[model samples]
Target: MTTTETPGADTVRPRWGAERIGNAIFAAVVFGLGVFALVGAFAIRVPAGQAIGPQVFPFAVAVILLGSGAALVISALRGQVAPREEGEDIDPDAKTDWWTILKLVALLVAVLLLLELLGWWMVAALLFGGVAWTLGAKRPWVAFLVGLVIGIGTQLLFGEGLGLFLPRGAAFDWWYGPGPLFG
Candidate 1:
């Protein structure tokens, strides 16, 4: 097979470039995600005799995503792609920090794995501390302490104040009767 290269074609037809195709594909993915969110939003159960429920926020977010996705899709199809961001602090030629990304991903996986066993607060603290330490925190112990405080505070705020209880510790729950650990 022989591929012919048309000289000056790229300069003449900038609209049909690789960036345009990538933008369109990204927009399509966003639109698909919006559709998924909309379906999930509709699946949420509303309490009987209540006007507004938890579904309201999801529905609103779904609508926003859908609209934005649609707009992006149209813009991309018309070759009106967004301009590349070039911040003063950013190095254009800098290589991606894959090591940092890998560490973050590993930490997230650990959080997911330990969420039920260690409980939300403990896992949250671990995640925060891990991220802080990964990002060059001088005092990792202090970071862990702060993460613990934040984790416990969120647990209290959501579980006690808002009545949205997180799992207390699945293993502990099985052993110590399903009562909440903190209230």
Candidate 2:
């Protein structure tokens, strides 16, 4: 309930709580993403003679996102802020680690940049391992191997089993033969 006086102003402004600000931002992002999803869903081309098109799932997801976002915004506006963590391993007094956050961001950026060049299988493995390491994985090599398996497995599942296209970069084209292994 404490208020801070503005410089060169007699009027005082109540400080906005972090929870409220975070909730508002989260709501806005979710709502924006929902709208984007809806737009994208509508833009998808429906093949002739298909009763249920690919847009159906995206539309459903968009509706859910919109509803959840609206609910979150309303709850936040009503001052029903999220509860703080009470974890045993957490230190409440510890300051935010900007460096770790930066590392994670950099890793994600690397993955994005390399996705088309190195393909989903290679880049996804790197991404998964990088994230695991950044989050303090005990055995990074094991994590990397597991991530590699997951990446390759997913590629096979989507590309071969499901007949879905996934990026297979030019660098590994030799291994993939004359035709593209994935879409």
Candidate 3:
């Protein structure tokens, strides 16, 4: 068929372009997140005598999100399209490994479910080791041991140094009094 006589050749252009639609979606998500963060930040109770309160960081993050979202929406309406990305290491045709993804998801769920029962120290170790194994670590035992040390160290750091409480299982309490090692 001739170009001039092609089907729907004189149709009206779409109201919004693909780039605008994508940018609008991105802006909506970002703006929604900003609103959520703002609400959460406002819910935090500011402690007395503190120059910078706990809400400061969250508020700042919310503001940044709001600003960026607005900028994106404005840019989209102005017909500013983003340039396509080009990278050396990216394999455009590579397919995702569903099995590996499912394994990682299962590990995460297991860790979450076991956290209260096994405690942060044990669960964190398992999480690290499990992740390493899922990612094809040759020596899982060594990874587990290293993860165990890191877990214990992190427990001590957060629980003792930062005064943040992490779960300590009943077994741990029975072995080391009512409180865990650093509790």
Judging by TM-score against the true structure, name the best candidate. Answer: 2
Which model scores highest in lDDT? 2
| Cα lDDT tens digits for candidate 1, 112-151 | 8888788878888898999999999999888888889998
Please estimate how well model 3 matches the true structure, expressed as its whole-model Cα lDDT: 0.82
How well does candidate 1 match the true structure in TM-score terms? 0.73
> In order, what lDDT does every prediction score?
0.83, 0.84, 0.82
TM-score, ranked from best to worst: 2, 1, 3
- In the order shown, what is each candidate's alpha-carbon RMSD? 7.8, 7.5, 7.7
Candidate 3 weakest ten by summed lDDT: 6-15
Collision pairs in model 3: none
Model 3: per-residue lDDT, tens digit, 1-183? Answer: 655577765664445876568877898889888999999999999878999977988999999999988888787776566755569987756777899999999999998899878888898889889989999999988889988998899888987778777887655666767544655
How many collisions per candidate? Answer: 0, 0, 0
- Candidate 1, clashing residue pairs? none
Residue 157 lDDT, candidate 1, scale 0-100: 91
Model 2 regions more than 4 Å off: 1-15
